[model samples]
Target: MRRTDLSSGARTQPPSVDRAGSGKAGPALILGAALLGLGLGAYAIERIIPRRPMLRGRVIYRDGDYEIRDYPAFHALEMSLYGGREDALQRAFERVSGADRDGERPAALLDPVMQSRRSNAADGDDTGFTHGRWSVRVPLSAARAADCGFESVDPRLRVISVPAQRVAVLRFTSTEDVAFGINRVMLEDFVEDEGLEAEGPVFYAYYGLSRALPFGRQHEVLLPVSP
Candidate 1:
């Protein structure tokens, strides 16, 4: 018979003690509750605030991803930025925000924010490298446009009128970061069918940008025109 020694060096786990379960139970519930509270708080805030009315133009004609419309003219404080897409937008935001003159508040300009590239010179570098000539146009109400003056010393940043004109509007749902590989065939077909001419650079408008999910975000590509 072996005698049971109380002062044995080896340790033994207690029977059915459930140490693992008991140890985890407290922290798991705490973490879960914390996460749940945060989610609820965010949802509440999202519901409480009113969303902005995204940019839109009257749809005179409509087809899938293509249409022709007469966009109303409006004034905007605009600036030309150079570099990658994100870089350009950041610079524009800073310049516009720094305006100490009218202490202007921007109407978020437009959705997806307008981005355009300048034409390379005929004799200029045909090299693979090309810099972006991105422009940001923040449209202003006629009353506000008249009242507000861009006093920024930056010559490139100035307020101007976007003359009311027609455009070939192409809409799609996409994240703003996607490369704008426009469906050239569809657009060209639209132009031919409508007997319209391409006049100026394309304007990209955005909607539903405030939503958290990137999927289903609305984007519109506006090609300027003479007709």
Candidate 2:
């Protein structure tokens, strides 16, 4: 099983011994151990630092179905990939996550970007995917954006600017592990009831990675609102 750090969106899978007599752990194992070390360190520092979401925006209004949030403009590095959501996440993880281990270079981490995604096939499309139209985005701080040296990862990843905007957000948990995509009715309802206009590319922010079991696993969808 893969575990994502709650404080930082670092992916950690359990360490496993190499079966080929290499006497070395795999990248996943090394990454896991490194993150475990950092997680412990962060736990100690959490006592002195604010422990809320590093990317959390201000909640301005709420009527039950959804809440209006005021989000300041933030820079993000987005990568569109031709794969399932998990594949995109893993690709994004291997590329952008802040981890140092076993001769592998550590990614820069001033403030770790929140792991967020937007699937293009949200309209009940049973097909997995046809083209490279889906995208995965990691919201980055200005510092991280400036220090980004991710030249060795996939070539398709690129940075994009996200303007300051208000968003209507909905929180929910699911029981299915592999299912994804924004709930159309909830988004539409929020848009209609709140009288808020929305733009394109809705976002999904998983509390942990979306691969976790559905029950009590928290995640949210953010619809960009017209300012």
Candidate 3:
């Protein structure tokens, strides 16, 4: 009989392919490449850029990376933050720069941002979140005539007058986010070896963006000492 066979006449269809996974993967790869390029470019810019002149201080003693410097009295904008170091730094920057409030005068940005760790014993609970203070020197013009009362847009920030003093400093360069611990230890060892006593908590001074390349960034662990 000439009757069409239903099975033979049935249309064959190709298997359906799921492209959702591959579609996402393509964009992710592109984004990753873009970010990598951006990071490299930033590192390059930092390397070639001329740094703002650091606040001048006389070197009292020098021993390789370790030194004793006599710094003059200066006014600084200081703030405390309790969380990630990056977040803390950003918030502190905004506060000091007057970007957080309207009609607030921005403080002059300066080299060598300073930082100090806050003791967790006072808080009574170690949540692993970072607790620290960040300080940046502002232009002398920003200081009030009466006192070191530098106006800040954020109440958390205040202007403090630092007295002229001699500090034991251990300088190093690194790419890590926080190099205070190891550098502090080294400074302490150097101070002890030199028969010097630490008069205050160890704080850090950074001369470059936190994200700058290791070679382009400079860090110092500073311990106030009896002069």
What local distance difference test score does each model get?
A: 0.62, 0.58, 0.65
lDDT (10s digit) by residue, model 2, range 1-227: 24566876676668655456445567768989999987777665555443223466899888665778888887676666565555665666556552211245333332222334344454555533322345666666555566565544546666677788888877666623233344534776768776778875566665533222222346666778786
Model 2: lDDT equals 0.58
- lDDT tens string, model 3, 110-221? 6677766664423643432255443443323333323434453466667677788889998887635546567777888988999988888777777765344444677788
Q: Enumerate residue pairs that collide in model 1.
A: 111-206
Clashing pairs in 2: 174-214
- Candidate 1 per-residue C-alpha lDDT over 1-227 given as tens digits, one digit per residue, 9 for 90 to 100: 23344687565545553455677889999999999997777677567644544445677888876888887877777888677555665577667645523534544344445655554423453421144667776665555577555644577778877778888877776543443444434565678678888898666565544455443456666787666
**Model 1 ranges with Cα > 4 A deviation:** 1-49, 97-112, 121-130, 153-155, 176-179, 183-185, 208-216
**Which of the numbered candidates is closest to the native, going by highest lDDT?**
3
Candidate 1 positional error at 3, Å: 29
* Candidate 3, backbone clash total: 0
What's the TM-score of every candidate structure? 0.63, 0.58, 0.64
**lDDT, model 3, position 204:** 71
- By summed lDDT, the worst window of 10 consecutive residues in model 2 runs over 208-217
Q: Is candidate 2 or candidate 3 better by lDDT?
A: 3
